[model samples]
Target: MELMGSMSVVEELREHYVAVVGSEPEYHEMRTRSGESVGVFEWPKGTSRMGVHLYASAGATRHGPGAREHAVELFLGVNTGSDAVKEGFANLILSVLKSNTVPQHGVFVAGNWKVIKGRKFTGWVLTERPDDLIPKLQLADGRHVVFLDALPVFPEEASYRRGNRSDELFEIWEESGLKSWDLDRDLPSVIERRSILRWPSWAQRNG
Candidate 1:
């Protein structure tokens, strides 16, 4: 599962992609203060149908001291086309990685799926697995689960109440002067809870 070679493989992949699609590609790296790495590549005008954003990052386990060397993530985003762009990008990724298989490990694909919703933002999901796998997918309301990862942290009821109170206090503070120190001091505990919850799970857990 280890990516044995240098970044040359990635660069080669980008070159081949640009030749086929006929557009310039851009790359960005995301690094943590501790030097953990994340890689991102964007195709501003790679194809007439869509622009692509590809992301990769190392995976870390809870019990490990640092990131798992071989574990990585590959995510793609295709914007500026019909709804088919999402599925198209997903299939392209599968095609590229299928020939370069990684033994004894799993690959996961996830992102925001575009759908017909009344609001500006809509949620959709898709998944495809090898035939030998157990077909881990959810088919409720045109959504499917593709990968198994950590469980999500759901917000509690108290958190919502505090958010509402905080909004009211902020509104009053904006309209009033600094003399409203009593209102600031009387802010609900939910505000602090909400602030803490905004941090990454690792920070919350390690804190």
Candidate 2:
């Protein structure tokens, strides 16, 4: 199916995919069937078997020298895909909200999340910072998309406006640096880069 972005899509998916501060940080654990701890954010109702806990956002500011415009970052397992699409993660969340039509991914609206219920919570953070705790996703299509637990999302790179959608949507995760970093070594520098790998977005749609 062709991936498309539209205002209607955003309006349609907002309610279900929104990540509001839960009542309790300690109780907001997303547990698997075997009581395996997942994440701090609450899972969608009836979603017992979670594959991954995705943290995606668009319109976040870019890092390094040329840091004027916003950029997109998709964090799963050990990979960090930058400039995901001009549209960013909103489209993917919207698609996931649709459920049957798109892959099932768990995402939260990007914002400063120091406290869930007026308490300092290090368990779950909103803004990105790689080498932190994150999760993988079990999309609706029964696909397991893996990514790094820690995010490369930086405050300076965080967008003032909540990343919704930009002109570029179909572009998806076409960046080349998905697996170019060595998580075992340095994440920012270039060493013996790992062979390129497919993006979670690619597996979600093209699968």
Model 1: runs farther than 4 Å from truth?
1-5, 45-73, 78-198, 201-207
RMSD of each: 17.0, 18.1
lDDT of 2 by residue, 1-207 (tens): 212222232222222234221221111222222222211222322232223323332111222333222222233332222222111333333323233221112222323332112212111112232432333333332333233222222222223123532111111212324331222223223212222222233211211
TM-score of 2: 0.20
What total of clashing residue pairs does each candidate reach?
Answer: 0, 19
TM-score against truth, every candidate: 0.31, 0.20
lDDT of each: 0.29, 0.25
Off by over 4 Å in 2: 1-76, 79-108, 114-152, 160-207
TM-score of 1: 0.31
Worst 10-residue lDDT window, candidate 1: 115-124
Per-residue lDDT tens digits of candidate 1, residues 1-207? 321223544554445445534565555443333333333345543442333432221221111223223322233333232223333332323322333532222222212221211111111122122331222222222222222111111122123223334334334435544222121123334334222222222111111
